[model samples]
Target: MGILTSPIPIQAIKTLCTNCGVRDLCLSIGLSNEDVERLASIVTQRVKIRKGAPLYHAGEPLRSLYAIRYGFFKTTITSEDGREQITGFQMAGEILGIDAISENRHACNALALEDSEVCPIHFPQLERLSHELPSLQSNFNKLLSREIVRDHEMLLLMGNLNADERFAAFLLNLSHRMLSRGYSPHAFVLRMSREDIGSYLGLRLETICRAIARLREMNIVRISGRAVEILNLDALRGLVAGCNRHRQS
Candidate 1:
């Protein structure tokens, strides 16, 4: 277990959605200025989580849904035998703790991969606000739908793809997401370690290392420790497609 720290108090400060950098990608999207102000009211506190510390633990009662203001996080679940399975990696502008909506307790643990800050939205207040704000309700529904689609995609990725293909898909997926967040798609740093990535992808650490070497040999990517630069974006995408390219128009 990582060392836990108390959340820094910020009663004097408030981060409003109108001034937030990631508002376009977050809940403020498609919302009126008034709606955003209403949201800002409920999001009264911002909590900073230290690296390696959990934002929330599994089976803990869900009090708030977190909007990641900065940094990276990984969600995982532990089995009865104490085997931990990485469920997903989340980044800035993404929401966490949605999995607890049905059970009222977190099904997985959320931990910061680096020093992070999150705006905690109290669940009950959000529910009442959503009732009055149709746009908020619609956006919340979309968030839920997106989670379901992501899960289905992961199932397909693990079930149908070979190791190499899975590795390619993972890189391409990361690239796309980074691009969406206004980061360079061709080059980026990996926040999670290779072992953490393996856990998420259901591959061995050695297998991940080999995949990196194989990509380098093919002149498709350049990897130096945690930094990765895709040398041939099209070639990398083709790797993910594999034989399926022949079937597509």
Candidate 2:
């Protein structure tokens, strides 16, 4: 059984929103100390999910929004033909379950790509608290707006970019996000499989491999298995410049 499939003991939880390492990247971004305390009160506990275990499945009733305290996850939607379409990947400090807020049920499945811990913030209590904390409300709105912008960008990537350009844009985007979170942008390990990357980029597995090989040949990035070291960030950025300009225009 998965770590989170059964009841999690209270002792298993080691953090809360107030003392969380990634609070600045999460909902605690604009809140005061006192306000953070109020937010922390609603986050009763953290849950550990084993790698490959799901935090929640599509159509499950959404009860809480999970803030990733550590590790990574991928949210996906399955098609009628039984194919999984990767929607997005979530890393430490990111929030999940926002998709459920609109329908009161999850629209996609959130699976931990690695062993992960997440703080569960009760949604009803969060709504009540947000009303009392204007800064919290504003932050929540910004999170929603960020999601919308991300979705828009994905659409642009899928529609306008070719296979190699899509891969380049994907790397640049991940690099930017990782840098913002204080990680080395030029080198990082990919937790997800190449197949997963192919699904997210809307390309076939062979296509993804070809794209990677092409990038490697050009010395834009050096990929040794899952470890990726960006060798020419500017070249990678240049590959996607046309698509980016199109989006801007």
Listed in order, each prediction's TM-score against the native is 0.92, 0.92
Cα displacement (Å) at residue 248, model 2: 24
What does candidate 2's lDDT look like per residue over 89-147, in tens digits? Answer: 99998899999999999999999999998888899999999899999999999999999
RMSD of 1: 3.6
Model 2 poorest ten-residue lDDT run = 5-14
lDDT of 2 at 141: 95
Writing each residue's lDDT as its tens digit, candidate 1 over 1-249 gives 453334433333233567787887787788887788787778867788889999999999999999988889999999999999999999989999999999999999999999898888889999999999999999999989999999999999899777777888888988998998899999999999999989998999998888888889889899999999999999988878774332111
- After superposing candidate 2, which stretches have Cα over 4 Å from the reference? 5-16, 243-249
- Residue pairs whose backbone atoms clash in candidate 2: none
State each model's CA lDDT, in order.
0.86, 0.87
